[model samples]
Target chain A: MTGPWAEALPWVIALPLVGAALTPAVAVRRPRAAGFWAWGVLLVTAVLAAGLVSELLARGPFSYELGGWPAAYGIELRFDHFSAWVLPLALLFVVIVPFSWRYLDHVMPDERRPPFYALLLLNAGGMIGFCVTGDLFNLFVFTEVVSLSSYALVAVGGRGLAAFAALKYLFIGAVSSLLMLFATAQLFVLTGSLNMAEVSLRLAEVGGGTAVMVAFAAYAVSFMVKAAMFPVHVWLPDAHAIAPSPVSAVLSGMVVKVGIVGMLRVYQIYYGAEVLELGAFNLALVWLGAVSIVMGAFFAIFQDDIKLMLAYSTISNIGYIVLGLGLASPYAVIGASVHVFNHALIKATLFLAAGSIIHQTGFRTLSDLRGVARAMPQTSAAMAIGAVSIVGLPPTAGFVCKWYIALGAFEANQAPFGFALVFGALFIFIYYIRMLNAFYFQKPVHAAVAQASETPWSMRGPVVLLASLCLILGVLGGIPLTFVEPAVLDLLPLWGP
Target chain B: MLLFGLDLDYVAVVMLFCVGLYMLVAKSNLLKKLLGLNVMETAVFAFIVTAGMVEGGDPPIMVAGTSAPFASPIPHAMVLTGIVVAVSVTAVALALIVQIHAHFGTIEIDELKELP
Candidate 1:
């Protein structure tokens, strides 16, 4: 299956990284050029990603060995169905970079644009590497790249408060990353190999034991922190809310998925090895996921700051994906996987819309921004669409995935969890409904909000496009299923729990 | 030298990890907390380096002095990379701490929390 597209694998990861390094140099004469430079780099990367996905479809999975070194000895990059995620991931970056061009004018001085765009490119490249790498050590390294860039991005916007939040995020994030590194080393000591496929084979030979179980536990905790699930999610709200809007959209929409993807990778290895009993762990995930859904919504109801509310809602959406994954039924896993993509689209719509409102009126709380819909109809409309989609209402992107997950709860005979899903949705609906009411029904409290105009076309275009995607994906929900189904089915036979 | 049926080196690593975790959780000073994170990184790095040891093996170099039973070179490479990552993380953390101090005029978590 080695085709011309296969040859392009390493370049997909390389282009953004190299582009990031070159950003400051490229923008030394004109800082504004950094944004366009980033957009062009990401646009090329997206084309290559599309080519790789097409190759995957035509020839199944393919691998590229770095320096022509064989697998299990040297580094390898594999393009399987799961790696198809890079396509949507790159496309999201392409959309986001354009929005950030004008968006940064309000967030930072012109001189700062170069480093900001550089960090964004670093983040995108790191995530692309994280998705496609076939080595455990490389996974840890890429996780750091993503995590380090995110810490910088969170603090790149404002003063003291943003720094405080970014520092808090860094402390927790660093610890989780250490756990991941520890787990990788543990596996390496046990198997003498860092390649994921080879580790699975060697793990099967080693059989189930305390050491393997401990490593699995470490990986689980590490990724859960990354995903910002419930108790360990303390770092998320402040970091996501305080970041500049485009950074907020990126962090809230995509960065947290690092944890979920890491979890799927761990599952692939352990399930392939057929080692240890995962039943109790799965139950724990189910309960924690349910609690996260409720708790996230419960907190969101009280937040007056609109960005903070959106950040809390992210915890709730992540809960849905986690719950679906925990169910372990084919339908559930497929739903969970597709939700990873859909939630990103919907959240980007909401955050960019919210950012536009903040950019125009400089008001963040719902009460301060009443009647905003009257002044800025299109942005508010996009926000409304995003809100509906997030609440899992019909004919929106969020509906299809949540419905499949609900059906999966039934299929798995977990009727209680199925009910929990609905209850959580109702809780989510209440808060978004509050937002809509504030936008459309309430009278204005501030003149700035009442007279606010629509954002410039650069920002508004992405918001409108992403919001339309929320609805379009709803009608054509089957598309992502085509990519996720085969991958889930391949792992299902050994998915004991 | 064994402690509680485990190698003494392993026991030392566990103790170091716990000490670092305690500082991270119990201390209110941000710099101390960061130092604690560094301690934790060192403990993990020590564990990986120890894992690659061969009791009586030569260094993993390929010159005339090195021979069979060479210590695994992969873990060394991994730790080297890990150290580079740790340094970068520390650099970022310190930069953030500087910003926090500049803005809030304090590096203590408790004081930062009390401010409006």
Candidate 2:
């Protein structure tokens, strides 16, 4: 029997692809209409995504095979807690599209608007597709789709450094994708099946060999680069800095987290079975995460550009997620998953607010943007809310995930990592305080800031919405923790008794 | 079937991957770097396509009446999709290089750094 959830599942993937196609065609005739059109489409996708989430909540996790074909031969799209990310992913796009309405006209020329929105929609669809698919090769295809669109989106920042940054991003991103494909090939060669469930079953039988370990390394490094973990995160700061504001929000907020989602899936496939020994790998993740947490915050403090600082902070936060996942305790997994969700909201709010500041004031650096709060009170306030949450302060979203991770670290007897998380939070706090000092205490340093106006309502609205969400989700941590706990249990049942 | 005590095809894949990676890292020219990326992509594709090979096997296409071990077609299909992706990336990259040249007047990564 066909259920409503089944009817709606494919539409979540289909609607945006359809909308992305129609955008440029609409733009050819009515260029001004493209932004509103995309917003409408994303709004529909958001509703469908929410429906999927509610259905999953009511019915538990389920998989839908495409085209009436069985899962082994055909593509399977799963709607477990991991894929439930489609809800927030789609809603984030809904927030970003309206923000782009005025921001695009403010930054770039008129002719590029339609194509810009098209790429944005396409990127969103790719990410949602990436999360929901259960087949291994489909993961690679969607990752490529997201990367190709992101390269274009980064390049669309209007000449000069934008093109170079996009090209560099392309080179690094392409190599990472190739590595992942190589890894996928290895898994296929070993298991003779590309479906994740089947491969997981087969990998258990022929496990613990040199070739398998090599494939594991390949997948780890490939996904780490995508997550923008410390060492390979060179491409992020410049790319995010040069991109248009809404694009920056989307990239920092959602796209990078897609990599973390990939890691979660990888862990499920490889770690769920007892054949592979992850002791060394998990320890490596813990230490690498420790280094990332400290080093990323250290680098972030030195960045003068607002978006660049936010970008570096992303690496640091990714460290926390990785650390928690490495611990492999039930609490740690829940913390990692919640942090993944929390950081997306906090960073998106921060980036969008920063974009608004740059939009109204034309200041890119803190030294030039002193006393921005006086002119753009709402935007700066939203930025402060994001900053508080990101710093893991009390009564905000960031604190909840950090708390769980800290408890998990101690429970797992990884006290050093627990301390690292604490020290890292202190370091993050210092820079955010510095930022606040620049915003409120210091006088307007540049002539542009002195003449700046408040951000438009269309832009200000989403920032406010996300900022408040940071508080609401923080106070109600159990909402996401509910979805997170079961998913973690299914993958890693090591937290016995 | 083997050279230097290693499978020849696998050896070739490793050499190609390393050479491509080296050029990507060491080369300063934008076009050369893209070339390196293409080489790396090709090497990965080669490894994948070779995995589908069987000893003394025929192509997967079925004849009227014959029983023979056939090479797997799945990897071949995957490689075809990969080749198209590689081409699209290369086309976009070359276009970006053109734009970079027009804007900064140089295609060398070092010289672009010197531009104001």
Candidate 3:
């Protein structure tokens, strides 16, 4: 149980917060150094996350109590296959840091840039803490940290529209936070403890009651807003679309996924044992996921702004994650979990590459950016890989998850949802095809695209690395599937039994 | 009169929450919406604090030789944390409201929506 890696877990959250605290002073002296400083801290974080995963690989799931206190008495941070999301999250921040450097120069004023880096680091710290913590109150605290930083990050764009978007995002996000906090309070009232494992044990004794059901509903609805699920997703498109590109990438790629992580943790805590009959709720998830998929895809097809389209596509992809979990089968859960990893990879690549194109050409819409593929082959190729993977094409990581989820839908005897999953992909394919056609086949509609060239390596490197991982993960599907399978089995033992 | 043996405190919390949510949806003034949000958060915090209360309990602090029922300290601690979070949110929302006012010259949500 003891090893060198034992102490590294807390640092994964600490380094980013420490860096955030240090950023402004460094920024005052050398504003540009803030990005580099943030970059260096995040690299260490990525390494630590990878180290922890290797430790987990050797020795299953483990929990670390804060301040050397017992779990029931103090906060405990659990690291399971699910929370190992810190690895992907850290990798995302590492990619985003370099991408932000030159992109911010154009979009953010010099005086504002330092705070931007600080906020970015804070946001990353919050997300990493959110992923790793097992205490419900700790989760709420981290969620606020992430939400508040993100709201500011959006307004940092300083566009009139961006300011308005940030305000709307603030209200919606704050209300979601309130809902989740209330739910946490309800669980506290029922269980007399806030530790997730302890709460689960107590809930088993208290049994499902009207209050517990109300709490579950509150958690589900609030997380639905946070995850930007279809109906409650009004704030996401504008907020993501108007933010500077790297922020958009992080918001789309990582932040919304935190809601999914929270939702999964709730399931792990309350629904893990078959003592409570949750068939109705799982059925509700399947339908909600199905509708979001179709609805999100339909909305994406109409958006002309490249980032807006990507943002809408995110809602649809979140549907896939929820759908997989709803099926409640091992294959489905694995598919859903792996999709979390794959979607983050693909979406982040697409957003970064899109940002680079916008930075280079000053064009954001399809028609204006036509023939971009001919000018910037590498960026276009990365986008194409991401697009192809997102459409659930074979030989790509996206396909691996969708395949399992679709298979799980059938195995769960829910063929209509399986059809919805595939049909949703087809709907998504139409828009991606539209984008690809505009990128490759159409002639440049403006001088920007005609004169466009490849982005510098600082911006290019992260997108290319992520694009390549899409293929590598697809080909080496076992790498993630192995990490995913056991986690699913541990959470849902009755699956396929 | 007995109120169906229900916790009246919880009923009041729910009523406040619904009223706050209604203000958020029904009103369009940016400041009022922020107020509504505050009200909602206050309701949640109140609920947590009330949940920790014992019918005739003493304060949660321990004394040298006393043995009386005491309110749970955890929920009170959580309420303190929630209050800080609530204040931060309110400050940010007010700042954003000022920006919106300066830019649009109005804080009414309806009027703001009419801007280009």
Candidate 4:
């Protein structure tokens, strides 16, 4: 627990943040250097994250106290099985930043690249910090860091509509963040501690009450907004779709996971305390999750814009995770956790591939992009792989976790929701089938699309690599379960009545 | 002070929070919505500061005369951090608003929606 790997924990979060601050300065003389600089930063962070995960495997969960302070008093950074997410999260950024280098030629001028990369790195650091922190207040701070940077990143593409979308995102996002801060303060007021473990212990001593329930409700609503669950999902589509494609991949793939991760942190606290009956709440989540699934895919079926469809699909995927969590069975929870990782891979592949096509043909709508597969065959093939994977076909990454979640639905004796899950997947499959048909079978409506050339290798490389990983991980899907199962087992005992 | 058996300060905070929410939802002006957000933040900060107050307690400063009943300093620290965050959010919101103004020539949600 006290080895070099343990020592690397703080540096994993700090490196990206420091690198982000240094980006503009480092690239001041040569603005193009910012992209390479950000990539290098994330590369090292991914390495550190891998080392930390290895340490977790060798040992169990470990903790690090900031400034030599003890656990109850000092801010603690704990890396349990759940925190293993940082490794993939950082690796996704490593892949994404490179794609953005050439992608930015269409997004903004060279001078804007530094700030764009900086915001992206800030976002990475914030999420990494979010996943690792063991203090409630620290969680709020990191959420703001991520939220603030995300708002700017959405508008960073430079358009009036982009600014408007970013503003709407800011209003809703800032409110959710305020709710999170209020919840944190409420917990602190009730327990007189900000450390999550300490707060849980104190809450156990205090037992359940209206105040505690209110705090939990606040956290729940806040996270649901962040996750873009059905009711509060209005802000997500525009903000996600309007952002540049690389930003879309990051936002859709990773940023939204913050809510799910934060929810897990709250569950760790409340479940550990054995406070408030969560049965009714779980039922509500199951119902809402089902609705989100249908609604997300239902709306996506109507969208012509590829990125907007992908954005809606994110809501549906989040629904699957929420439903799995609500099922409260071990299989369901494990599936949901692994889906968190797999969906990121699948979505990033789709977005990057879509970005490449758009970059080549200057087309975004499916009707306008017909027969694009003829011109950019590799990118289209990658997009097809992504589409198949997202629809939960066998031997693809999305299938594994979703199959487990379906089993979990039946295991939890929720036969109806299991059916719902299947139907949701069918709905998802229909839209993707439409997408594939447009890409491969149709004649090009726009001459520009017909004459479009393939993207540079810089962009095509990431798309192909991610698409291959989609298949590779589909076959090797059990890898993430090794990290997820123990974590869910640790949680399920106190889950509910 | 107590209002209907609840602390008046808390009642005030809740009322202020509702007022801000109303402005954020009901008002169309983007700037007004931003101000409303700041007001809501202030209310939450006030609630935290109020939670830290001790009955007739001295400031949480340790020189020689500090006693056991000193006000909790942690809430102050939290509020200070919260204020800094609020300021940054406000700054970002304002910047976005400026861009919207430039692009659409309107900051009212109603007018903006009518354009294309």
- Residue ranges of candidate 4 with Cα displaced over 4 Å: none
**Model 4, span A81-174: residue lDDT tens:** 9999999999999998889999999879999999999999999999999999999999999999999999999999968999999999999999
Clashes by residue pair, model 4: none
Q: Rank the candidate models, highest DockQ first.
A: 1, 4, 2, 3
lDDT of each: 0.94, 0.88, 0.89, 0.94
- Candidate 3 chain A has its poorest 10 consecutive residues by lDDT at A270-279
For model 2 chain A, where is the 10-residue window of minimal lDDT? A488-497
The most accurate candidate by DockQ is 1
TM-score of chain B of each: 0.95, 0.94, 0.92, 0.96
Taking all chains together, the TM-score of candidate 3 against the true structure is 0.98
The candidate with the higher TM-score, 2 or 4, is 4
Tell me the TM-score of each prediction against the true structure.
Answer: 0.99, 0.97, 0.98, 0.99
Candidate 3 vs candidate 4, DockQ winner: 4
User: On a 0 to 100 scale, what is the lDDT of residue A126 in model 1?
Assistant: 98
Better of 1 and 2 by TM-score: 1
Q: What is the lDDT of residue B35 in candidate 2?
A: 99
> Which is the better candidate, 2 or 4, if ranked by DockQ?
4
The native-contact fractions of the candidates, in order shown, are 0.93, 0.56, 0.58, 0.76
**Chain A TM-score compared with the true chain A, each model in order:** 0.99, 0.98, 0.98, 0.99
Give the CA lDDT, 0 to 100, for residue A199 in model 2: 85
Tell me the tens digit of each residue's lDDT in model 1 across A348-426: 9999999999999999999999999999999999999999999999999999999999999999999899999999999
